[model samples]
Target: MEVFLSICLGLGLSASSGFRVFLPMLIANIAAMSGWISPAESFAWLATWPAFFALLTATIAEIGGYYVPFIDNLLDTIATPAAIIAGTLLSTSFIQIDNPVLQWGLGLILGGGTAGMVQVGTGLLRLLSSKTTAGLGNPVVSTAENVASFGLSGLAIFLPIIAMVLVVLLILWLFRKIANLRKTK
Candidate 1:
């Protein structure tokens, strides 16, 4: 039961990472620092000050970069792989398991997969926004993604089960959106 909840928490945070990589890490570090959550034994560093400060800096940079016009699209190309790594890391940090192989494998598959899906969905939306609005609508898209990242991270920490439900719904929505986009192309 505990493992399940923790995995749900990880998945929720991973989904948030899909929107913005560092924000979810920052939020999780804050959660750990505040004693709201406990990371896996090896991930104890996640609760430290250095990790917090580094993640803070990265988060701010990531958030600001998205508000820029062409740079946001460029960032998306880099972010897809980064989000997968972050998602896997964030997911693995919560799973309190004895078997290293199973833990990491699940983290890579479920967490990375979730983040990649959401990232692709957002990337497609940004492309559409760029084309339709001539980049004017990108900032709005960036802002919404940022807000969703924060909101999902919060829910992942405080209400993981509900967060997981929302993440699943988000996945479904992404699937539909991606399929429609492909059909249009």
Candidate 2:
């Protein structure tokens, strides 16, 4: 049961990484520190005091920067790759599998790949909005991302399975919208 819950948390956190990378990490790190979640032994490093401080700072900085006008879009440009790496690392960090190969494979594929896909999808929306609305739609995008980040972070620590299901739904929805846009063009 513990393992299952942890995996679910990992999936939820990975999904959240798509919206705001550091937000979920900060949440998870705090949870682990408080013993709300029991990460794998290897992830014991996350419970350290310094890790907590770093994530807290990063989370605050990232979210605050996203509230700015043009700066939000610029952050997304660089955040894309960083989100992918964070997603994978966070997923694998909580996983405690005896099989080394399986751990890294799933970390990169499902964790990193899913986060990267979602990040790129959101970035494309921002790009389209910038091109069409002249960047006026950025506030809406930023707000939605903040809601998603908070929602997924909470779900990751509490109802992880539900969060994973939501991630799948979000992916499908994004894909459909992207497809419709392509067809219209």
Put down candidate 1 lDDT per residue, 69-100, tens digits, no spaces. 99999999999999999999999999777798
Q: Cα miss at 29, model 2 (Å)?
A: 0.7
Candidate 1 local lDDT, residue 26: 99
Per-candidate TM-scores read 0.98, 0.92
Top-scoring candidate (lDDT): 1
* Alpha-carbon lDDT, every model: 0.94, 0.83
- Candidate 1 whole-model C-alpha lDDT, 0 to 1: 0.94
**Could you tell me the lDDT of residue 166 within candidate 1?**
99
After superposition, which runs of candidate 1 have C-alpha atoms over 4 Å from their true positions? none
Q: Lowest summed-lDDT stretch of 10 residues in model 1?
A: 173-182
Clash counts for the predictions, in order: 0, 0
- TM-score: which candidate is best? 1
List clashing residue pairs in candidate 2: none
